[model samples]
Target: MSNWKKVLSLGLVLLVVAVLAACGGNDEEANSEENNEQTEQESNTDVNEEEISIGQINWAENIAVTNMWKVILEEKGYNVKLSVLDMGTMMKALESGDLDVSLEVWLPVQDANYLEEYQDTVNFSDATWFDNAKVGLVVPEYVEEVDSIEDLNEHKDLFNGEIVGFDPGAGTMEVTEDLIEEYNLEFELLPSSEPAMLTQIGEAVANEEPIVAPLWTPHWIFSEYDLKFLEDPENIYGGVEKIHHATRTDFADEYPNVSEYFKNWKMDDEQIGELINYVENADEPIEGAREWVEENQDLIDEWVQE
Candidate 1:
């Protein structure tokens, strides 16, 4: 081969190599930009997730329902948190927009005042469980002498002329005072929380002693003990009640999907009673709720609408 021919071939090979190297560089640069774009898109999706904070009240149904929502929201890729609070504090939190949703709000019976107070600032879903809740004076079936509120004044000494009541802010507590006045019963209400009141009832029932206290339905206590609501012909105890969902006013606008899910949520008496029983018997409410969510995927599917 001639020297000029060899030199020409070498130059041709070097030019091809240089061109391929430049193309490879461009390809690497394009790949880098593509990765960066994908990362940004995923980060934006993460930001779109709504962080839902719930004001879970101290009650069996509240514990079961709120934690159940926590599990469902988390499953749907939402950020969820629960704050265990009393009815008063929970209402305040909802009014201030600090809490996102609460699945249990007994109304026209136990939480009417709270509802009326916060109706302007907070939002409530349609009645979730209707005609299940009942609130009034209750006693163990063993207490045969006191079948009605009117009989309470006659046997006031049996109960020490004291009526066990629920939380100070509890609607039942407020109504019970009216009961004392309407019945003209010479009894003082012992203000306490739900758990404390339950403990009192448990002790009295175990001892077969005559005891009178505020009680309600959709409560695990009814399943655990035999109790009856005293006759209130005057209807001072009101009528059959329902449970509603409560959320912050801005929640729906901020997260439409979640709001829709809540709006469609409903649980019947048997469903909630079983859930409350599970939670009360489980190691923790959240743990039980997680298991319930897993076992009840069909129900969840029905709830999470488009």
Candidate 2:
């Protein structure tokens, strides 16, 4: 009786120990699976959290390129927001880290003041998109009387004693102010929006009247109208500038992929000109950008390649 009881008790104890060990193994496996699922979910959350805010000026080129990048980035599964800001506000936003990126910053000449002030706070792209940019007074070809900024005072009456200018704080307007002071021209610069300035210029040109306005290259106006940049003998208006993108100083660290895309971004006059023209004529700027992006998949692929 004692032997049988001992043997039975030993077998029962061994069976219980084996069953408990199996249960513990299953628990460990379940916990491991749960931890793996959580890690995968967190990684996906990080990907979904990748959002970028781009600051864009209302200038023609800036609008075109900013919209184009927005389309491209969104297509690549990024959340992109675009804000139309003035030159001063854009720079300040970049400095304060409110904006992630800006696609237009004319360097070595136009926008020099903003760049100088925000250099420490912002980071510029390694390469420029457009290298041949200019800012100056422009007129229709029919304005035969005024061929140069030096000739403006002689024909100031033609422009109604005021020069058509873009935004008040724009880089071009700032340089135009200096031009007026340096040339001692008897003309006033009327601070107007780009569309307003363009409307006035369009009317003046339509009537074969003379009109002078602050203008920039790579703009759609040059393609739409037979216009020419007035000569600046004094060279107050910066001759040629390279357009570069800028971002917050920490942008690259946070968004390495986007930073790489911007570094690889480059466009010549023709490409940018076509983009501006397309955007200017489209029903909406983003529509035009999407069209351009659709047609340029190969180029976009190169830019977004990791």
Candidate 3:
């Protein structure tokens, strides 16, 4: 109603508006600082400085092979980091270019579909690790008259109508499923970790109890346990596979020297087996592998020599 009263009300409204704007600005600045801090932390955690990062899957052989590569890369004076992941996650990471390399791509078996889908994003090197690498239903030596996958159908009662399996996404597990379906075998494929499955095999072998499982070669278990692969008369399981090395498409160009060494990497069963055994049996994998590489420097040099 009065001029002074109206002017005072207008000033009060302006003051409240200014305070609200200041509070909003402060909140935005705080959010900006938090985002920048997170970005810095992520960059610090990533191995991004001209270093070679490899992706390894869940398998003992994969661990052995990955550590060997890590050793070779370190010896060449380049930083290398390995991220252990499952096959599915590993493939997605490789496709998205988060992971640089995968040394154990068991072909026509695990991740076969992944390779086909992500070939453009990745380049698979020639099989760096190759062997019979067979996957089939294996039994302890005491399974008397059973000799093959087909024969298991008749003796299902003995094995409690079950076949031990490794990780669910494992190549061996995939093949085991096919074998069961193809042969019309009445057995449940129980998925478990490789160590657990192998422990079961060991116990079964010790007691001479009948056991069937998805098994592979060039594995230390063969040497540690007395077992035999049940004959695959139906041939449902695929034939021998060559374990390969794979890298993100830009890997060679991005880290040429490290790529060169990896491209030239190759060895037979004897050489790999020695390292495998050393890593698997020894308490310290990195220390054990490092010692093996140092002792066999001549062989390593031969592979990485320019």
Candidate 4:
């Protein structure tokens, strides 16, 4: 009785110890797997946190180019956000680093004041996207009588005693106000948005009525309408300017690749006009930009190449 009972009890104790050891090993393996999964998830979050914000103005060319870059950056695995802002707000955002980049900045004249104010805080691209850009009072070709700013005063009534203008804070509108004072024109400068000004132009042109409004080149409107820029004898609206992109001062150091892309970015009249046309006609602006990006893969690749 003593020998057999002692042997059985010893065997049972050994078996129980072996089973507990096996269970501890499994627990360790499960914990290791769980930790590895957590690390992988954290790594993916790091990758996805690579985000960029682009500021866009409501202007036609600005809208076109901003969305185009948004699509391109998103394709390159960036979490891109597009923020539509007004001129003053955009400039301030860039200065404060609230916005990462802004694609459309008319320089040497159109937005000279903004550059002068924010140059210290914002970094402008080395290369311009478009050149020979003009801004002035535009009239349909049918308003042949009003060929120059000097002639605008005489025909103020034709434009309904108002010069249909773009947004109030826009550089174009500022210049238009100065033009009125310089020319001693009686017409009031109406402050409206780009789309509203375009609608006014469209309606007046369709009816063959005279309508003078603030306008700029590289815009789709010129392509769609028979229009002429009213000659500025005083040259208040400076000669051809350029369109440039700007970013927060620290943006380049943080995102050198994106900064390089902005530096290399450029577009000619035909190219920008085509983009604007696509954006303007499409049901959704971003979709239009996506279509353009899809069609211009080679061009984008060239831009993004290291």
Candidate 5:
């Protein structure tokens, strides 16, 4: 072996090692950047993220109640974003930490599964936004000789043996099914969308026809149409309920000021019912909430102002 051959061989080996090292370093850097981007997206926190995110179920009470918070929060220098979703879906999102807050959780009416499962991950408001919320069968003013669920069995022919219901996933549907089994009532539970059910009831009431449906309080239906909840002698729908706010477990820690605003926030049945009435009967949600806020500035200022 010659000295030049040995030296050249050693230099070649060193050059190959340096090239591999450089390739490895590039790969690591690329991976780090990708991970950073992903984290940023999941967090989705704005650089100027002074806004508070609130989740809202598609019910009138939820929409109105949450919007009331939105108004209060905004007045206190916090921007607010209301994310509207279905009841069940909204609960799942709140449990998974996808949403920030929900102010429409009705006690004993909404599913208990999420409440039990995500108890550790969620926090409920100290004060209830509204009470007197209810769920049960309702009949129009024109429905004579039928004033109770028990009375329905005899008048099956009047309603075609079908009891109209709201969306399939609604808690009212669950209670209605239970009511049927408990009483052994002979009737079909028609699960339809909110709009569909409302349209049917509206038409029936307009023409003085008999109509039955799943109904709740603090809703605009009473204002839109003359209706009465059938006497639930069996009490299958549970008693009066209270609505409150639920947020991520870390919400208070992350946004203390916003949490304080939510904590101090409260409204009576009349205030919230009026808000719902505006959204449903008044045909204007955003405008209605805004007008309500403008008209009731004193009440709002009590919550946020000082």
Candidate 6:
């Protein structure tokens, strides 16, 4: 217990305590610097983005809904691009990220094919409009000879032994073919484009001639012409279908505001039917959509949610 020994021990203890204190301070400083760096990195990653791309088909429902979104998204200070494509091609585009959002995806019926294939890769919004879709043997109301699908086969000669049909790829067309088989009808399901089919119907109706064509709901023809769907007793044509909006899975995340607006969009049979009529009467589809948007500013305002 000499003085020198005691001083040496005290000095060693002080040296150890000093080293521990320095290490703790260094650890604290290192943690603070790491956290600051992480915060800055995250802030740097948080960029404001505002552009979106859309894909749509040429069909009546698709055209109307797609153009409708195109007009509104533009009004919301977001750059929106709408590309016209076939159903299959549109699905492919959405999957590849070439497009951001798409319109008029009919579920459990018309768009069943596309949804089955791309539901994993794509995201679907809640039904914009519940499925009120109808596909049947549509005839001008003037043709009183055929009231139900059964009556059509009896007067096949009136319809010229031919049934006009829309694009071959459409879901209605597929079911129509099945309908023909299911009913065992002796008729030809002629495949033609929408415009061509419309032209035929217009010409036929102009002269009050009889024509049986495969048609659906929310179409301009329903509004402009007196048409009736042939009663389907066998339930071959199935039931009403809903229309939905679709996008790449990352769509809602990348463009949350736009996504919210999409989810907010809802329309009924009359509203959509009116839009289709407007488009059918207008010179061009986009102009028709623009006119509709202009006329329905209040509804659009409601759809653009905060």
Candidate 2 Cα outliers beyond 4 Å, as residue runs = 1-46
lDDT (Cα, tens digit) per residue for candidate 2, span 1-306: 699999999999999999999999999999999999999866544245656999987777888998999998888678999998888998889889999888888877778888778888888775887788888888899878888888888877777888888887887788888889999999989997998999998998888888888888888788789999889998887678888889999988777777888888878788888888889889999999999889888878888786
How much is 239 displaced in model 5, in angstroms? Answer: 1.7
Using TM-score as the measure, what is the rank order of every candidate, best first? 2, 1, 4, 3, 6, 5
Supply the TM-score for candidate 6.
0.78
Runs in model 3 lying further than 4 Å from the true structure: 1-48
User: For candidate 3, what is the lDDT?
Assistant: 0.77
Q: What is the C-alpha lDDT of each candidate?
A: 0.82, 0.85, 0.77, 0.85, 0.76, 0.80
Model 3: how large is the Cα RMSD against the reference?
A: 13.0
Model 6 residue pairs with clashes: 131-241, 131-242
Per-residue accuracy of model 1 over 85-202 as CA lDDT, tens digit each? 8778888888888787777777776777777888889897774744567888899998989888988889989999999887787677877888788878899999988888899899
Reference-based TM-score of each model: 0.84, 0.87, 0.80, 0.83, 0.77, 0.78
Q: What are the runs in model 4 whose C-alpha is more than 4 Å off?
A: 1-50
- Sliding window of 10 residues with minimal summed lDDT for model 5: 41-50
The TM-score measured for candidate 3 stands at 0.80
lDDT of 4: 0.85
Report the C-alpha displacement of residue 207, candidate 5, in angstroms. 1.4
Q: Any idea what lDDT model 6 has?
A: 0.80
Compose the digit string of candidate 4's lDDT tens values, residues 1-306.
799999999999999999999999999999999999999866543235767889887888888888899888888767889898888898899888888888888888888888888888789776887887998888899887889989977777777789888788887788788888988999899897888989989999899988888888888888789999888889998998998888999888777778888888878888888888888889999999999888888888888886
Best by TM-score: 2
lDDT of each residue in 42-108, candidate 3, tens digit only: 6444224566778876566778878877887776566888897877677777778888888777777
- Provide backbone clash counts, one per model: 0, 0, 0, 0, 0, 2
Q: Tell me the deviation in Å of residue 253 in model 1.
A: 0.6
- Taking the tens digit of each residue's C-alpha lDDT, what string does model 5 give over 1-306? 899999999999999999999999999999999999989755533223555678876666777777767766666556788887766776677777888888766676554545666677678675776667777789987787898889988988999989888777666777688889998989889987777888899888889989888878877778778788888887888788776778888777777656666667777778877777665544566667777888888887766543
